[model samples]
Target: MSWFRALKDTTRSGLTVERKRLEPLIALRGTAGLAVVIAISLSLFGPAVAAGSAFGGFQAAIATFQRSWRPRPELALASGASLGVSTFLGYLTGSHLFLFLPLLGLWTFLAGLSWAAGPTIGIIASSNVAMMLVTITLPTTVAEAAGHAAMMVFGGLVQAALVILFPVRRWGAHRDALADALAAEADYARRLRHDPVAEFDPAPLMLARSAAALTPRQARTRPAQLHGTRGVAERIRPVLASLADPAVGVPAEGPERDRARELLAAAGSILDAAARAIRHGTPVTIPPGAIAAFRTPDNGTILSGPAQRAADRLGPLLRDVVETAGGTLPEEAAALPPAAALRRRLTRPRRPRAGPAARPPDLAPLTAAAPAAPPYRDPGRPLRRPTLFELVPAAVRAIRREARPGSPVLRHATRVCAVAVAGYLIGGALPLGHGYWAPMSAVMVMRPDFSQTYSRAVARFGGTLVGVALATGVVQLAHPGTELSAALAVLCAGLMYLLMRTGQLASQACVAAYVVFLLGMGGETWSQTVPERLVLTLAGGLLATLSYALYPAWETPRLRTRLADWLGALGEYAAVVVDHYAHPAGKAGPEVRAALLKARDAHIAWQDAIDRAGTEPVRHRGLSNAAADDAAHALHHLGRVAMLMEAHLPERDATPVPAAAALADALRTATRDGARALRERRVPRWGPVRAALEAWDGEGVPDRVVRRGAGMLLEALEALSDALDTDVPPMTVKPAHETDGPREP
Candidate 1:
């Protein structure tokens, strides 16, 4: 009697726990039923509805998800999970009840649209509830509501079982991703060293370069193990302070202090180079001078001579890399060639030609080299915030140019709306007796960014397959009752949260698991139903792909026009640098910096646009083998000129030559050539400008100005000519230092 009582008590306890779990589900079912009745009654008694409410829900969810998900993988996972969870909760509350089924179908469709736009666990749960409610409303029976609720309980249980039992491996995947990124960076860096003007915005190249520099040991370490080396040079501050004190006895601090400072400086440079390389995707070579100083024997006294020598060598290199990376140049430097002595003379400053009547500025009167401007001060810190204003305008322009003239926004919106409507009508008309999948297909097919479209489709399919399989297995084994069902619901909620923390794949898996649970909970004894759900999902995916591929919205194809515009802007900037250098006595400040910043921003944008264009499969053949190569070369020359201008500003400002006219003439010639190259799709003539700048005598021009302007102009002309000629194939544009040896001081 005692044993029997104990058994009965255990059974009762289990039953009570199960009953408690079922309460929320019951309430959820009741709410869903009530919502459907309201929707139907409104549809029948009032004006006929055309599934607006359903479509709206689908649109809102897609917009919300797309807006939130970014390129960063971690952020993508988190946002996807959150949306999933939020969606599930909405179903539980029966909020937006009429739209719930539509959203579910939409989620299914988006999964096919792109890997990045797939449905989450939350979406699956919401869909299940919505479908159940829609079915229950067909009979308008209280018994139907109870039956659906019971089914939901069963579905939830099956999902819970899978989560607890399944072992998901994530660490390996993360490591692989990191490794791939690093490898890519390394390859890019190697390429940049060989060719620097191949592309603009070396950030990708630099990132790859920096990652390559990392030893295998470093690469293998977990993210947690790799302590952020940000501001690591700050640690050397105390040692620098100790060495600065003159009061300390020379004997006590001499050799050790000297060695320490040398190492610290070298280390600092290396760290800075590493940071720049990573941020800009450019390679940065350490100067030999710094290496020599760092290798000095340990001595306490500050090794002023060696340290100074190393610093001197490093200065020019550092400045060049920074300027190149930033897309700025000085006024007078010759086009960059092998690092060697190639003296160029400065021409006298010519007065601006007075309209058409003004005699061309006289080149007969050669001037002494212009005085150099003050050495440029480092901006101190790198610009971190990406300029969105510039990006947005460019994007808008591209979109407008690419779109059919007039009401692009309206056109796009109309097309999207049409797709949605078509999906809805078709889904409603399908004999499959479920109208959820059609609207889902529409949502998936409509996307602005095409890069992730394929991946999204694949992930969606894979996730669904796995989810259905798991659901099928659990339903067979559990034979879910109220207790089992309640347990499953709670488990699903927890898994949804966990999936949100994982990645897109995991999140999709959780959703799939939940869907499987729903199928089982509805008291459908046929396991074959899982296959039907899979087929429905695939159908939705296929429809989405067709929509994207057929009537796709595209970015503008006017890449050459954009490139020409940038070159023109660069010419104007070059003129500014030359003008500043011509007046040696002029003070240098924010103007130069501002010009440099603008040039940098423009260069980056140019590169980004090119990348986008390259990714379009239809345009790839055209882009890969077109005059883009020549155009890129010309831009590279412009970039070098900008760097040289910054480097020689001090010297240029001090020069006294009146050769401003010659400088202006050369700039005009180069600009015209660049324009012609773009118009005719041929290389520009760079020889005349190069020869003139190189041959000009700096006798009357100030030496400082001559040295600065001559070097920059010569280099600019060479680059422009080379770019136009197409004799030299375009290489990836690297940050200045990465391509060449360390920049000259």
Candidate 2:
């Protein structure tokens, strides 16, 4: 009884898992079924009708493949080649049409090659028309001619069906990907607000790119698909504008008012960042004093001095809304203090004497025997930016650019054509008929990814060899007669269906084997053809390799310029972040969100550029690497700061102080110090002094809380400076609690 119960439970669990896995497939089944129905309908029609439909279908499929296969051109070409080979072999042996086999093989190979190279539907249709004419003259029997024609038509129809079904299912996937990306960004922002140990990271940026790449058909929409959920500009525009309008007074309700006020504050910060990005491309540099003030814990009232000054600068309507709402703002709302003031207090102004200029040590030396790293992993350092070669289509594009117009592709095509011509010439000279293996091998070897090409070549060779052996055995079992031949033909159709469903490579082998067997049953022996095909195949591969090596191709250049451009953009983005923090509540948030999106787009572009750079030849490597790494680090830090500012804005604004002059002086000083440090190539130290000033400026927070938060921020800044070897300065300001009531400008 116990065992039986356990068995029942296991069965139930298995059923649950199966149902879960099958759900998505079931949802997509309708479209898949539609494609299958079209293929089956075409097959049911008589050979003549099927032939007409096949021509049109093949043309459409080739055109679509060209447009969609930009990133994976080799795969498209291979698929076409596989189709042509299967069709030719099917007709040669299945219908006992030995005399027409060589002609059919050549025609199919040329047609497939042209389609793969240029993808013109019209050209393919024309090729089919020629094939139809040849079929009438070359086939000794009507049935044989009809069977070959039908194979061509069916092959074309299948290609068309697959293309139509793929895109429709991708749209929903993109939406889901976007939602996941936004949620991840929000989570990262929240973590920055709560965790002091955490530093900025570009994982979020990477996630965003991945999300963007997903096709829409695959995306699933959730409630968070609304722009507001992602902190996008569209979400904050209304709230920011409302805050500047006096008519919409702060709500009298409790939680409702709180939510409204919080939204308004967030919007203000976003707008401020956007405005700053427009004014200057670099990130807004935060004074150490401002960081200290926000870190203070005693309700942040001690920081109100600079906050009030910022409020005074706002238009009347916005000031009224804040006052009436009884809402506080973030400490960063006070314009950042100067870097010079912070630097003067923290360290001497003189530059460090140059020896080695504090060079960072290289962790790994170059070695021939060292294992190469995977594309996703950094070649050396943990946080290094990816090189261009790691990316796919970019590498191919870069190579293409090196050659003159249409050189690399055209050169390859020409070599393939030459191999076929040579094969025909050799056949004529020897009186053994044109060899199909030479041209077929050329198709197998043409690939952008070396690994894929290698695998396919092996598979093709193995499958063909096995197929010929199997044909010998089958012919020995069944004599050459019409009834046996017809039975074998039916068996080939079943094999085609199975192979198509299994995989292209596997199917190709199966088809080849069936063809060999059919030929033997028709009185031709595999022992007579096997050795000849192998030799021809070797000839084709050699020609293909020669063409690829000799073709004019572009070498990948150093990607430093692209990386530098991205770094410059990131600097600008950081400046915008500072502006967002400095702006008065209700004035900065909307615009800041817009700026964030721009930054996100810029990062995506940088990734693409890097991918392109990596694929280039060994020359000009590691050019933009340093700049890209620095930019990534900066963005991670800025994102964290933005989250913190958003979380504390309301509490900080409630403080009242009169330290505007001191804060501004401190900010100016810090900015100057930072500029000087950058020039000197030294890390600046200003966090301690900034913390002291923040402790002194704020009046609302209990002295201990203000002191502790300020201390933490100061320590954090010091760590950052040490990590990046760059200096930052402190800002000065008076405590907000010491301020008199609202002051005149």
Candidate 3:
């Protein structure tokens, strides 16, 4: 892609409006917190101090609004406390340029490195740097600076307290996530009724799983309705696919197909009803038609053998879904109180009993055999979020890991530090009084990727212009007092919070206006602040954007490494599943689960890398676009085959597939070497896999399904090798450290 097209696409994306629901109540709460902080600071310390402290409440509120699984109060407190510390430290060095410039570079670099932790941390840390730049200009002694810092912390505390006292829709994010997953499954089922081979995106289920991970306290206090639904949802997806697929369950078209379609339609209805109930925290009201379809006995006519078994498996899972949704069983709707029963009947009309209502003999049990609180437990690494205290060490380790040469985090830090210092020097040399705006803008807009940095540069500049113009107009026309300025600031902040999800351009515009009013409250006239801010913001944005082109960290070059990682992870997952087949007594053990989780993470990472690489204005050096797509498709097939095998895992005492042992070992060894070969820019060979499969030829593996799945895996691997070998040429790429050596401090 050309630079022009990349820049154009990124700018359009940044400016695009997302029609997300506005959180008016949450915005009001944040704005109210800011209002309180401004009122307190003005009453006690005057408008300038109020202006300085407002960053705490504003930034704290913004932090809480980030898409994080952590509690809102915690995010608020951390944002406030960090800003206070950054302000105090900035004050200590503000008197001397020699001292302050180094401090500025160090702080900005640390802020850049914080991205290694997560986007939330990176964003909050950048805001801290900006707060420091703004607040250190307040002209105060060490004692006075400490007092101002304390007031800032107080502002954060106010926001945190408000969040704890008046949370709007508690656990709302989790509810929406799980609801969306169920809704997605419902849609998939409806689609499969027509197209049996319809593809389903696992992103929603992945997000639902992420939302399920909880802290120890959260685990104990979680709502009962949330438990076990996700697992049942996970199990239902494969069953739906199995029931619909022509090769696996029913024929292309017959009475069995019609029966399958009925079951699918009913499943979709049941799932959609459950989703609605869970999302609204109301009683589940599954359709009476759905209830009847599941209870109808085939009598060995409609769906037989595997199709019948899948249908049977699905019925109990759907029942489990409704039960876990709100414990509103099909048979118990009439037993509720008059109003409740009426509501249930309106939505979940009673269905006639099909038989004794006894649970099917072949029905799979729920989590009864496992620990009681399965849903609330901290899942494995990908979904397991660390507590704030735990995060300190984890963050430290992350920074240390990214400290080496070739690390994108390190490169970003270096580039940001360099640009910030240069922008500061240039701004200071110019006549603009607000020299910090230039460096602050540069720091805030820069990210590890090209698209965000460029897009944000456009957003920040455009937003700054509109914001300055509007605030200047308001100031000149109304000639408002300190109190009115504070009110306007709060209003702008509320708008910012409300539009937080509506893309960067919109929110940044409000942010610009808010800052203007904040400074106006500090007694700075529009003339003194407006022009300086506008000019300095432009300078800073340009510096940040230009620095990327000079010191680029392209994802295109790292595509092979990411693809290799995915291959290795996928192989391990396949081997683990095959190993389980080899030793049926083990079932799906922790190792298998862990491997599966790792592979999924790797898959997500690979897709993310591909996406990032696609937007970059660089050539595909090692892997072309077609090759990547083909390889991705092949890997996806490999994952699906493994998932199918996992769905049909043998019973604990079932006859073991002796051939699976050798096949699993070969997969583990061959994929390990294949990944290495890919990394070294050589075509991968699956000779071991071929040999292992050949050894079982004509011997007939005890489990034909396992053998078939293993054969599919081998085919996928071969296809992947062919995809890579067709276009990939031999090349020696330098290690990241060698290519981008770390600068000496």
Clash totals in order: 117, 94, 1
lDDT values of the candidates? 0.39, 0.36, 0.80
Regions of candidate 3 where Cα sits further than 4 Å from its true position? 328-384, 733-745
Q: Which runs in model 2 stand beyond 4 Å of their true positions? A: 1-436, 449-529, 552-745
Ranking by TM-score: 3, 1, 2
Residue-wise lDDT of candidate 1 within 1-745, one digit each (tens)? 1334433432332222111112233223322322332244234432111121221122122222221111122222232233334333334433344565454444433322222112332233223322332333222234433333333332233222322343122122332322333333334323332332223343433332222233233334323211222211111221222222222211224564445444445434543443444343333444445434432222313444322222232323333222322232333323222222121112211122111221111111011111111122322232222122342354344333433332222233334445554555665676664454444433533333333333444455566677667766777787785335424533543354434333334445555665454334334443545654566566655665555557653332445545655676676567666666556535344565566545554565566556545444445211233456665665665655454444334433253445654665677577656654644444556555555455555334444323444565556555655544545433343111101111000
What root-mean-square deviation over C-alphas does model 2 reach? 22.0
- Indicate which candidate wins on TM-score: 3
Model 1 has an lDDT value of 0.39
Query: Across residues 105-135, which tens digit of lDDT does each residue of candidate 2 receive?
Result: 4553444334322333224322342334222
* TM-score (all chains, Cα) for each model: 0.48, 0.39, 0.90
User: Residue by residue across 376-398, what tens digits does model 3's lDDT show?
Assistant: 22122234567777888888877
Question: Which run of 10 residues does model 2 get worst, by summed lDDT?
Answer: 736-745
